[model samples]
Target: MLKEKVALITGSTSGIGLATAHVLAQQGINLVLHGLVSATEGQALANDFIAQYGINAIFDDADLQDVASIERLITKAISTMGSVDILVNNAGIQHTQSAESFPLEKWNAIIAINLSAAFHAIQFALPAMKRQGWGRIINVASVHGLVGSVNKSAYCAAKHGLVGLTKVLALECAEQGITVNAICPGWVDTPLINDQISAIAKQQDSSFEQAKYQLVTAKQPLPEMMAPAQIGEFILFLCSDSAKSITGAALPMDGAWTAQ
Candidate 1:
């Protein structure tokens, strides 16, 4: 049922979002890719998908922080691809600091991109989804949404909010043939977390591998870090007919992190 359907994924230029795009494209889904990359780079990635998957693809660098730009993004996707059958709200930013010392600007930016952008994207995409009587809305939330960590107040807050939003939207669209859910993944071996691992390595005077082990083992019962493709595969499963009944869930792919 997903073949030839259009999916719009935000923050899709790299990391988990990019992995999800690849999974969807491979399923014969047309794509509306969004990222912060330059237009040329974004278009090249879209072209690559088209060439490799023989699927339609387009790229847009919409500013998620701006409501107008996000609206335009959804509008353009619908106009170009007919409808956004899958909406992945994966764009996010993080700033770590004590709650007391967190910069207001950083807090606002995080909330805007990580949380509010998802809200706006959902609002704009729901109409098209409702019209078709089917949609898959996946929010790439984090384990932080279910639990918490020090120096990650804003990130936790936004992720928690996203999970809550997932539930509400799911209920609202449940009978309407839309499944809204969040994927709460633990550490995925993505470039987005590379700097953090490197910093841990420096602080502990250890190798990157050693630091990565320490980091993952600290919270996850399973020390192995997840791969971006694993999350992509999970998402693909959620988009299938078998998963049509699994809605309003913040499913954790987090090595049992929150299990403790």
Candidate 2:
């Protein structure tokens, strides 16, 4: 069903977003790569998909924090690839600090990128999806959406709000041929996480391995960091015809983080 369809994935320059783009492309889907990366880098990534998959693709370096930019991305993507049948809200950022010590600017930024961007994208994409009578809206939330942790006030709040929005939107679109859902992933061994581990090592004055181990096993009993491609594959499944009935669900890719 994904064949020839267009999927605009936010934050597609690297990590899970990029991985998801590859899987979607493999399924014969066209793409619109969106991220904060340079235009050159973004176009290069888009060209790679076109060269490898022989599918239509383009890059948009839109500032997700700007509602207008988000709208332009969808508009341009539709003009480029025909229509956006799949909308992946995957762009995100993180800042860890005590709630009391959390910078107001950081909190606002997190809420804007992590939460509001999804809103703007979905709002803009919904009409097209509803008009076509078939679409998938996947919000790349985090394990923090389901549960809380220390020193992650802004991220936690934004993710929680995302999950809530996912449910509400799913309910509203339940009758429509559109599905809205959230994917709550655990610690994936991405660059974003590697940086966090480095910070942990620095603060604790410990080896990288020690900090990595502690961080991975802190709540996730699996004691292993998941691969970014795994999340991508899972998303592909959600976009499949089999997952048409799945909506308003907050599926966890965490290794039993919330289980404990």
Candidate 3:
């Protein structure tokens, strides 16, 4: 059922979204890669998928902060790929600050892109999905969604909202053959986590490797950060036929962080 299907993964130029795109492309899924990249760069990345995986590919430079842009993104994907059979809401931004110290602009941006964009994308994507009687929507939430930390009010709020949205959508679309779920991952080995590790290093006067170890072990019992490819593979499983009954779950691949 996944083969030849079109997936629109926001933030597909980097991090987990890119990893997921690669895995899906390997499964013969056509892709609409969305991110902030120049036309040439985006096309180059898309063409790479075509050359390497032999799947149809295109890119949409949609600004997820704007609801109108989110709708346009879905429309553009449908027009370009016939329909986005899989929609991955992976575009996100983060700001590290206490609630009182958080910048208003950062708070707004985090909410818009990290939370509202998924809602807008689902709102737009559901029509075509309902018409076709099959769709997969995966929201890339975080362990923070299931738990919380200091100085991360905006991030926590947005991710928590995403998880709630996933549950509601899943219930509403249960019989529509549209599954909605959130993947709550712990410290995945992405550039974002690398930046956090660097910040920890600078603050604690530790080496990069030490910071990485400390960061992962702080919240996780497993003592290892997860790879982006692992999340990608998990997403692939969620999109597969065997996982058809796994809707409405906020599944945690968090190395037992939330279990603690």
Candidate 4:
């Protein structure tokens, strides 16, 4: 049922978004990959996907901070690939500081890209989905969406808002053959976590592996971080017919972080 369907995924140039795109492309879904990369660089990734997966793929460098750009992103997806059957609001930026010390510009940028962009994308994509009578909207919220952490006020607030938006949209689309859900993942092995681990190692004069262990075990009971591809697999499951009944859930793939 997923074959030939078009999926629009923001932040698809790398990390979880890229992994998810691979999973969906392997299933024969055409893709509208979005990121901040240059068009030439983005097209190279798109060409690679086509060569390896034999599916249609295109790239867009839409600025998620701009509502007009986000609307155009959805428009381009539908115009270029027929209709956006799947929408993944995955583009996000993060800045960590005490709430009182947080820069107002950083806070605004974080909220714009992380929360507001998703809203605009959903608004534009919904009409196409409504006309087709089937759609899947997956928001890649963080574990912070479910819980909280020190010095991450803005990130937490935006992700928490994303989860809330997911629930409300799910309720509104419950009878319309559409499902909206959020995935709350703990530390996934991405460049972002790698940088944090590197800093921890430097600060404590510890080995990389030791720093990684300390990092993951501090909050997550599981000592190892999840791979980006693992999150991709979970997302694929959410897009399947078997998951048709699941909606509005901020499902945790956090290795028991919230369980604590």
lDDT of 2 by residue, 15-112 (tens): 99999999999988999998888899889988999999999999999998899999999999887778999999999999999998899999999999
- Please say which candidate is ahead in lDDT: 1 or 2: 1
Off by over 4 Å in 1: none
Off by over 4 Å in 4: none
On residues 16-93, what C-alpha lDDT tens digit does candidate 4 reach at each position? Answer: 999999999989999999898999999999999999999999999999988999888899899988999999999899
lDDT of 3 by residue, 1-260 (tens): 78999999999999899999999999999999988899889999999999999999998898898888888889988998899899999999988888988999999999999999999999999999999999999999999899999999999999999999999999999999999999999988887777778999999999999999998888899988888889999999999989999999999999999887
lDDT of each: 0.94, 0.93, 0.93, 0.94
Residue pairs in clash, model 3 = none
Clash numbers, per candidate: 0, 0, 0, 0
Top-TM-score structure, candidate number: 4
lDDT tens string, model 1, 143-239? 9989989999999999999999999999999899999999999989988778889999999899999999998999999988898989989999999
Candidate ranking under TM-score, highest first, comes to 4, 1, 3, 2
Question: Least lDDT summed over 10 consecutive residues: which range in candidate 2?
Answer: 187-196
**Residue pairs clashing, model 4:** none
Per-model C-alpha RMSD: 0.9, 1.5, 1.1, 0.7
RMSD of 3: 1.1
lDDT of 1: 0.94
